[model samples]
Target: MNPFVDIILRSCTVYFFMVLALRVFGKRELSQLNSADIVLILLISNSVQNAMVGSNTSLEGGILAALALFVINYLFKRWINQSKTVKDWVLSKPQVLIHNGNVEFKTLAKLGITSEELDEAIREHGVESHKNVKLAMFEIDGNISIISGDNNLKQTHHKRKIHKTLNEL
Candidate 1:
């Protein structure tokens, strides 16, 4: 086979494998990337590169692989949008990890997350403590959504104070 044809074939194979892997791994939103998720993405890209370029070191091989990946991803996204079942399965439903200031230990364990991680997530949302959170959910995309109790009003007040100071300045 000509080097060009070999490159194209390798690219197609890698693109197909990527599509299959993505289907198997389930879909998650980009904003929801956690540490583990990021590592998985990196590993997948590195592992698939050789499969995509084969033994060809030409620029055309790399370009072919990249283009193939783009096309496959575009088609997958289109299909996911049109199919409800596929959407649901690919995008997992949110799981409640904490409720009414109490951590759901079972759920946490199942998600392979620690209470400390949960606490950090809550804090990132500006909640002082878990007690201030009314609801905390682990989104399918690996993000934590925190719904604060009336304590959010306190945060609002703090924000207002800062704005007022800035305005005066």
Candidate 2:
């Protein structure tokens, strides 16, 4: 195989593999990055560099691999946008955490969210308590969104800095 073609194929393979890994691992990871997350990401990038470029360490080889990644990513995004099935499979749907001042304990447990975290999110949104929240949702992007049941109907979003992995919880 031509060196350039080989690089492209390798890059494409790495791209798909990374995507699959992220999807399988957890989409919540995309929303926030802690120290461990950042370190792991850096290490993964370093580890995959050789796999994508192979023996060709030339500037051209590196550029070609990056180009292939960009093209593949663009095409994948377009496909995801066009196909509902693919979109549903690749993306997470928003989860309702609270409704009508009622906390969804099952949802919190499933998502590995603790009551303290929920309370913090609620307080950040300026709601006195969960009972004052009309609706709370764990959005697809991993942020907690709150809507207050007050007459003013305040709404707010809180970006979580830490997330407990499902295995840990």
- Compute the lDDT of residue 118 as modeled in candidate 1: 76
Point out where model 1 deviates above 4 Å: 1-12, 19-44, 151-169
Backbone-clash count (model 1): 0
After superposition, candidate 2 runs with Cα above 4 Å error: 163-169
**Deviation from truth (RMSD, Å), model 2:** 3.4
TM-score of 1: 0.68
Compose the digit string of candidate 2's lDDT tens values, residues 44-73. Answer: 999999999999999999999999999999
Query: Residue 63 of candidate 2: its Cα lDDT?
Result: 95
Name the top TM-score candidate: 2
lDDT digits (tens) for residues 1-169 of candidate 1:
7776666677767776765677686555665455667899999888878877877767877887677777767887798899998777665678897789998899988766667677667766788888877888877656777888865343311100112343365
Alpha carbon RMSD to native, model 1: 8.7
